[model samples]
Target: MIKELVAGVVATTWKRLHGPAQWRILWLKHATFMIGVTGVVLDDHDRVLLLKHRFWKDCPWGTPSGYIERGETIEAGFAREVAEETGLTVGQVAIHKINSGFRLRMEVSVIGRLIGAAEPQVDGVEVTEARFFRRDELPDGLRASQREVILAAGATS
Candidate 1:
């Protein structure tokens, strides 16, 4: 009986000593790999495409953004998100900007040109509406970060 009690105490001490490492192992198993991509579409008139997101109650006016799906490259993910949100096919993608905040996760912004004269069609659940607006004509409800991206795209357009 004493041997059994001593064994229990040793086991408890060991668990307390390595508890953090075990917890880290468990956290890594459940950690989500967060990634996001944004497409900056510009019209010939220097107007930028903006999507009104239905899910975002705090900031509705945002860009066409979505997560990078499993087994997809960043560029391909951006193209897929653009096509899924707005039915326009992207011709070419150019890395416009990159924002990294916390945990080595990144939000990649790419400038995509619409193929031919195809218009944008909002078809995704997240994207409720889509429209092109000039820099000065940006809607008042746009998020501050989105406004910054639109102005940056305007400068390069």
Candidate 2:
């Protein structure tokens, strides 16, 4: 009965809609998710990297993250964002967690290791500050979701 009612509603709604509405419903049925990759990158000492971005409303500290580019692998995008914002290279990465449901966008947290003994060198433009913080002593103004990602990554260490 519920299925029939739903089907009836869909049929009724479908008939009342025009071209754009049809496309919207079609998109709703076959929407592609936008993936934003977040890195829980850590150094050998298990310190988590944090960045203070300039364009943010309050310029809060957060992990290195960006939307995945077309045809770019998740790990590659993760490393790229870190390098672009912090000027630090990262090694291999593996998927750590997936957070979604706010909309069609998804946040993928990946675990990656810092490459060598090099320190971060931010450009002082897009990124104002970049450094690693001890797990127990993260700075103020960290986004709750990012803090949770950092803590969850720490738990797995």
Candidate 3:
């Protein structure tokens, strides 16, 4: 209790010294958490795109996903992750869900349509394979939560 009170006093004094604008910036830096993006990329046939990441152990086959780069909007980051991992462009991007990314990270899930005729070609290093699977016949090893997200995206269109 004494430590908490002392810390509170120090924070209040620091806030007053910095003024509101600087205090807000300092508070945001201390409070904001990491955000990541995942996508349920859909093709013309309504198949959902999935990738086999070389690094994942428990679940190697999953949706195209990555952390947001600095100055990137969630949509832009999602598109970049897809393209970087699978060599496929995505359009019609729309946020489908926002949920816990993992331990303490925040996730933004999006639904996007495949923009071109080119099929998915994995990066070969980070991602060993990329393929689109029919919604009715998704592959094994995909996280159940991701399967639900993909199904939910299919339900909308």
Candidate 4:
């Protein structure tokens, strides 16, 4: 039901944007909608991987995440984000949930398995620190939504 509603809204908006010259201007003005992806990776010890983002000051520790690039599948994008942020290769990702933001941003969360026994490392730019933590030992300042996603992912796994 919710998916259909969202699809209908997007389709209607796209169709409405194809009208006259004034409406074309409206379309040009509304740019930069983003689809983001998050991965919940658990090690053999049931520890979850998290990255301390260098950019997000208030909420630093959260699931590895980034924007989905054009022409990239959501699972591929999630794998890319995890690798770029933590240097950990993803095995298989199972999508768990999707949440839309108040603005034009949408986030898809997934539970992913790591490929090998690689340790976490930072990219030194987007992510400053990467580490695995037990659920009770998760660090402070995680985003509320991301915390929920992590819990959901853990539950599914």
Q: Whole-model Cα lDDT per candidate?
A: 0.77, 0.86, 0.87, 0.83
Backbone clashes, candidate 2? 0
Which regions of candidate 1 are displaced past 4 Å? 1-32
Candidate 1: count the clashes: 0
- Sorting all predicted structures by TM-score, with the top scorer first, yields 3, 4, 2, 1
Looking at model 3, the pairs that clash are none
The predicted structure with the larger TM-score, 1 or 4, is 4
Tens digits of lDDT, candidate 4, 1-157: 9999999998887776646855667768876678988878988876899888888878888888889998898999999888877788997788888887548888888888888999988768888888889899988888887788778867767
Candidate 2 regions exceeding 4 Å error are 1-29
lDDT of 2 at 154: 84
Ranking by lDDT: 3, 2, 4, 1
Candidate 2: deviation at residue 77, Å? 0.7
Model 2: residue 22 alpha-carbon error in angstroms: 20
Error of 1 at 112 (Å): 1.7
- Error of model 2, residue 16, in angstroms: 32
TM accuracy, model 3: 0.80
Judged by whole-model lDDT over C-alpha atoms, candidate 3 comes out at 0.87
- How well does candidate 4 match the true structure in TM-score terms? 0.76
* Comparing 3 and 4 on lDDT, the stronger one: 3
